[model samples]
Target: MDSPNTLAVRIEPMTVDDLPQVLEIERVAFPSPWSARAYEYELRYNDMAHYFVAWLDAWALRHPANDGVIGWLRRWVRPAPTVGAPLMVGYVGYWLMAGEAHVSTIAVRPEHRGHSYGELLLAHTLQDAARHGAHVATLEVRVSNTAAQQLYLKYGFDKVGMRKAYYSDNDEDALIMTTPPLNSGQYQEKLRRLQIALTMQLNTQMGRKLSLVSRTGA
Candidate 1:
């Protein structure tokens, strides 16, 4: 079961100042975490790279005077620099290429796992992609990540193919997954159900404790 603290977790957008924490989580989560230089390159060169973080927000009430910022998630429409104030908690990184939205990465902090943050992030990403004219979304997952595979399946992504020796660190094959055409009524119904499930899970985790305004104020 998810801890109450995890239920109260928040997502936010990544910022240049968040590199340290972001890299820390990356290092712990992946054997081949992208290097600081690579992240720098993404921030600089990539016309379409987004990054985000997720963290517990219990401190919000304890440190009310401090910034209420918590975790984040990031997604990019282009490789350009992110604009405006950052408000990410867990990010779904994807690329909109040739009319398809390709999810490149999704990660949550270890302490915040199994709380549906990833699903929330993906749902938000899909919505954004649809709004931006993407008709489909694709992603590749490590064969060993059964949990992630199940999550993707719950989101209506299906295994369409695979790539041999796709992961560099272990040379593991990757399972390529794709969603049904986004315009289909069936797909929309599935997405709606998933979104409802996600919201309910989040609310349950939070104990449906308070109004959004009160919670945010805390």
Candidate 2:
């Protein structure tokens, strides 16, 4: 944890308003990025789609502490009025339909990648998919992305197959991975334990003394 007072990072349903930040990350992280119009269509017209954004809490960015009377006024009289938008650090998207969930994409800003915010997003996605009656979840990651493969394996996803030339930009093969049935007790218990550890990591790294909101709005 860099600072004990750092605000919580939150994941919430992605809306049209989040496209700009989301696209910015996509462009930087991948050779080919989905366009804003594609994202808008997913948000507005794709009934099977589920997407989310992770943003930092707005408090400290808007009210960086002062050492004198103004700081005193903020602490004792009234909290400094929050200004500006909370930083959007990451996002994830997937599709759920007919008992299956397919992860479409996920990325964290390069600067924010090490803080476990990406793990937080992945955990939330699986849990949310299960709630919506998805029995299994799957995704395809570039064969070269060992870090991502390890992360997925940590959560019970197994490499089940391969997709030849799955990535359009470079014709890179993708490892197809799938989880055991999400509704099964074994899988659920594993996810529950992981969720606990993930929450602790997020709290430890991002600070969650307060302002941890519900999944929908966080």
Candidate 3:
């Protein structure tokens, strides 16, 4: 198994082409996975929805052991970008309404759950929301999901309310969480610092071998 240290993280807009992998992840990550039709609707028709996938291209990180002249050339010459599919380890989705960004879903493959990748996804979502002029962010999580609640709290979200029997599948109550104004200088500065810390964490974990690319254009 490749270490989390070997991960090359890339976040891009989710596409129909990515559905198979994303569906697999969705199944493994959640007990009640979203249907393919629903994902298709979001990707193809929803205008206010923004979705992203976290890709781990370990091949690049695993192939840096060559030496000598060929190695020198390889080091200096960037590999031609290949049109290959990526390994989808996680995904997130949110809906932008008025000036609020509402997180609809977030998940990571079971094998990839413990390495702070969820936080990375949430961070990117918040950052994207801020970029799009969103004043605040919100989400609803299962009342029993303490791990997720902790992550939200760490990112400045607070428990605002609850929806009784919000989950149709099990009639579970949902805890609503909301963050303070994201456009404020204090919040932005906090995000900036967290982004820097994530960069350093990834660098230290990979021994400086990987780059974290989280682009919002998609």
Candidate 4:
């Protein structure tokens, strides 16, 4: 059985009120965090934007005095219902343009990186995109980000192309990837397999942590 602490994390949509918290996390997570004004614009001006936060009960479960966001994602929606809430433990963001879904960004807090939260967020985002009638999903990742590339490939996304100097930080090129057509049985099956693998991985990590805590207490 999972411990109460492991089950307490929640994935919720980003609201106007969440910007302060989101920006804080962004500052800690990204060297070039988006400005507060940028976040404000996203919340107020962009009708197609959907943001989310991942809330992890880090302190309450162990330390008792520390709590903070564990992950976040900002997605763009095109004429679809916005999903927002309990502040997610990770987030997936994308844009819909010209009948294709273009993933903008997906980030997990450093502490939460190995726990499958990214996978959860991606799954949720992909499901939502399908629900919103996207036929194809696309995204670009830094060439150096092999971990992210593997994750995308696991979901049936293929290396379709590349862009020169796509990321500004180090002028890193980006590898453009695209998923098979949405609602296709092959892609859905791959997604299902990936989800299952992610679930197992998360559960294993949670179990290990819980066991270590129990042993140390004993």
Compared with the true structure, model 3 gives a TM-score of 0.82
Better of 1 and 3 by lDDT: 3
Show the colliding residue pairs in model 3: none
Candidate 4 residue-wise lDDT, 121-197, digit = tens: 77777866776678988999889989999989888899999999987778899999998898888877877787677
Q: Model 4, residue 70: what's the lDDT?
A: 24
For 42-135, candidate 2 gives per-residue lDDT tens digits of: 9999999999888776554343343467667655754433554578878998998788999999999875577777887888899889888899
* Candidate 1 TM-score over all chains jointly: 0.73
Query: What are the per-residue Cα lDDT tens digits for candidate 3 across 1-218?
Result: 34434557899889998999899888877768889999999989998999999997745324344346776676466432243435677899999999999999998877456667788899999999999989999999999999999989988999999999998889999999999999999999988898788777766654644567888944
* Per-residue C-alpha lDDT of model 1 across residues 1-218, encoded as one tens digit per residue: 23223334444555566777677667778888888787777766675654445544443222222223332211121121233222233445667788898998787766446767677777767766666677999999999999999988888899999999999999999999999887678888888887777777666664543221111100
As for TM-score, the candidate ahead, 3 or 4, is: 3
> Where does model 4 exceed 4 Å of error?
1-6, 58-89, 208-218
Q: What TM-score does candidate 4 get on C-alpha atoms?
A: 0.75
In model 1, where do residues sit more than 4 Å from their true spots? 1-12, 59-89, 209-218
Worst 10 residues of 4 by lDDT: 209-218
**Candidate 2: 10-residue stretch with minimal lDDT:** 209-218
Total backbone clashes of candidate 2, pairs 3 or more residues apart or in separate chains: 0
Q: Give the alpha-carbon lDDT of every model.
A: 0.65, 0.81, 0.82, 0.64
